[model samples]
Target: MLFYLTTLNLARFLKEDPPFIGEDEIDVQTQQAIDAWKHAEFLCRNYLLNGLSDTLYGVYSVKKTAKELWNSLDHKYKAEDAGAKKFLVGQFLNFKMVDSKNVISQVQELQLIIHGIHAEGMVLSESFQVGAIIEKLPPAWKDFKNYLKHKRKEMSVEDLILRLRVEEDNQGNEKRTLNPNAAKANLMEHDRGSKGKNPKHKQGPKLGPKGGIAKKPKFQGKCFNCGKMGHKSSE
Candidate 1:
């Protein structure tokens, strides 16, 4: 389950509207971390489902080792790793979920991981360090360990209520905009007018003498408004 969730999140990150970073440009260390997480998740899941008790411990150990490897990566390496760093950040949530026995604990841990990832992404000038990231977490999160110990199990309820609330809230805040097709058409029309291609559009008409088109003056004329000899003005 954790493996699937990580895979899905990684896919979404890669497929973002403008893309966070390029996949092909990712560095070796980042790619190694991504592969390690994927392999660890697979081994952990297989060991658990197959009821291989001894192997399960080994799998968990490997998972921890892989996570440590990821956490130790330097900022220069991470930058070169591109999308791999983002992928590894997401894998932290997967790591928390893999061993958690309670839903609340899982959610809280996942939330912390998300917050850390967000902070790391936002702080562009600094190096990403696991210790530094943990240090930056809010006091509320630090106190959550004690809070989780006393928390009761929630009732088994359908998630439809939450879904409906989210939908309604989204609808309320949504902005209406011109359709892309209409916007493209409007832009094209604007460009045509700006380029003087729209025949009926005119800012000034150079009227011809009588029925013929007026010839452009080769030299400056006296201004009609001020009666200046070197300049011409139109009322």
Candidate 2:
């Protein structure tokens, strides 16, 4: 899909009014804009294939609709026509419906396309100084990019701290690696201590004659009936 777009005679399709010449020939910015649109179209195609299972590349159909709609609008209304803009917006929203089932994968791909569109919009808006072209972008696409930028900024301090902590832990672990067997033994010992067992009987303080102050008895007696510890018959 990307190959088809880049290889195709896109300049011919663009139909520049005066026919761009040597210096006016496809500039890098224009090329990037075309590339972004091409990528978006490719993603839209794949999205339709997997989502609708129609096997028809619907992006061309959508573009046809956009072109027809653009032509139908009044020359003065083209830039501000809410109705025409809504048509494009509706198409974008329809494409978004494909995201529900394969959300993670679809979103990942869509995010790339949206980012590309946003970047392209920025270039067009700045390089050509076309506000209307910038406005042509889907509102959701613009919002998504803004949201991503905000989230990135919000995480700056926390991300720095987390990265530093990870680096510190990596250095510390590299300096001293624990033996697996010893680590396993230490874990078992810790577990035993928590289970009311005398893990270090020799090191533990001894019981005294002080009333109720002695270390609790490990066992009272064995039950003859149930064969359980801490129980005795009143014989």
Question: Which candidate ranks first by lDDT, i.e. highest?
Answer: 1
- Give the Cα lDDT of each candidate: 0.47, 0.44
The estimated TM-scores of all candidates read 0.18, 0.18
Question: Model 2 residue 128 lDDT?
Answer: 26
lDDT tens readout by residue for model 1, 1-235: 3355365443232122222336877799877767765665555444334433565455444423323323333333577667655775666634532322433344455445556666666442222333233333334345533343344543221232243235435534552243447668899889997997776766576767686668867547778778778674664
Instruction: Give me the displacement of residue 202 in model 1, in angstroms.
Output: 3.3
Q: Candidate 2's residue-wise lDDT over 81-184, tens digit each? A: 55545554454345442312432344344444444545434222232211222233344346533443444333432343354345446645854575447677
Q: Worst 10-residue stretch by lDDT in candidate 2?
A: 124-133
| Number of residue pairs clashing in candidate 1, backbone atoms closer than 3 angstroms, sequence gap of 3 or more or interchain | 3
Shift of residue 145 alpha carbon in model 2, Å: 30
Please count the clashing residue pairs in each candidate, in the order shown.
3, 0
